[model samples]
Target: MPYALTCTLHLRRQVQLLSILTVFSVIKAGHVTREGEVRWQLFNECSQGMLQTYLGRVNTRGFSDRHCLTEFHVEADFYGAIRLQHAQSRKYLCFNKRQRITLRFNGDSERCYFYERINHSGYSELESAWQPRLFLGFNGRGRFQSPDTYHVKRRCFYWLKFVRYVPEEELHHCEIRKPVDQHVRLEHTNMAHNALRNSLLNQIRATHDGPYKHQDQENRNGTYSL
Candidate 1:
């Protein structure tokens, strides 16, 4: 009987040990699952933040295929510059608002000139002509405040450019002329017109259906009367 009793005690102890180990394993698994959930939440929050920063308040209707003269205003935290080009005329104009400077480019051996005051006689002429295809606008480094902060004196400038090309037609009839320096205040005009153009293009891509689908639909609907 004493031997049986000893055996029973041993069995009870083994069962107790097993129960404790099982509980520990369950706790560890719960901890791992909780950590994974926390990590996923963090990643989701970060992605949303980035999306808000870049894509928030984007203009939806400003994208189109028709080319025309356009103006824009630019405001950045530190420094800003504007570049404008007429698609048809090939005229290139640039302005540096922070530095109070302007650059004009004509497709000729006549090198580009830089000016301090827009219309002042003390304009500094650059030895090299302005290259619209190469360096059309100003390049500077600066930081931006979060969307929550309001910038009262955020440096603002106006930019103007013309687009004259149709997608299906050759660009031979385009006549781009460089803009002469004027004291006009075109606000938000400091953005490179080319950049805004590309943004417009991206907006179209984001919103419109692919060309193939449109064409396919047209074909199916017998709208291609060609």
Candidate 2:
């Protein structure tokens, strides 16, 4: 073989190896820390809402009166595989055989696992670990939809933000005390529920002056259920 041809072949092999490494690098960039279990609110990037689990069903909502349904226990591995369990219901978020996202009590099954693919901007795409090709995404109507497309508009549905979950009591305390650094206002998010609860409690305390006085006391002591 000619020396020039041999050199050309070597260069091509190097280029092919580099391309393979680049693809791996992109996948590795999404690796989540294998630390202890953490709580998170799955914030959808396109829908601009949080993922909620209710009665073994899954959907994204702008705001919900039941805030606990929006929180999930995130157990992530080094390779980005995760298991999300609803904090309130203790149900595992699973992708069913029917290609739908659902919740079940048994979390040990393979269907409960999801592989996280986070991008440079900290947005994550959760692909089903049972079927890696299928992604946990949402439709335009903010309903759960497992996307099977390889390269067509995946970000609009699959991309999400794993926001650290903060308890409503702490948020409410900060708002009541009027913290200087933190701006306190209710928008179309989870915190809005707290604000509404407070408003209802205040109304109960002010309007009920007769037989409901005991209920007013409970409201003042923060034991009120609205």
Candidate with the greatest lDDT versus the true structure: 2
Candidate 2 regions exceeding 4 Å error are 1-37, 62-66, 77-80, 165-226
Clashing residue pairs in candidate 2 (N, C-alpha, C atoms within 3 angstroms): none
Residue 56 C-alpha lDDT in model 2: 58
lDDT of 2 by residue, 1-226 (tens): 6778677756655653353233222233677322233356776765667788765568776454345767676665565577887776778899788878788889877889987664444456777889867777776566865475435766555554444434334333212233453333334554778889987877766444633457657778888744
* Residues 45-108, model 1: lDDT tens digits: 1112110111122111222232322211111112212222334333433323332223334422
Compared with the true structure, model 1 gives a TM-score of 0.19
- Return the TM-score for each candidate structure: 0.19, 0.51
The Cα RMSD of model 1 versus the native structure comes to 32.5
Candidate 1 residue 80 C-alpha distance from true site, Å: 16
Q: What local lDDT does model 1 show for residue 205?
A: 58
lDDT of model number 1: 0.28
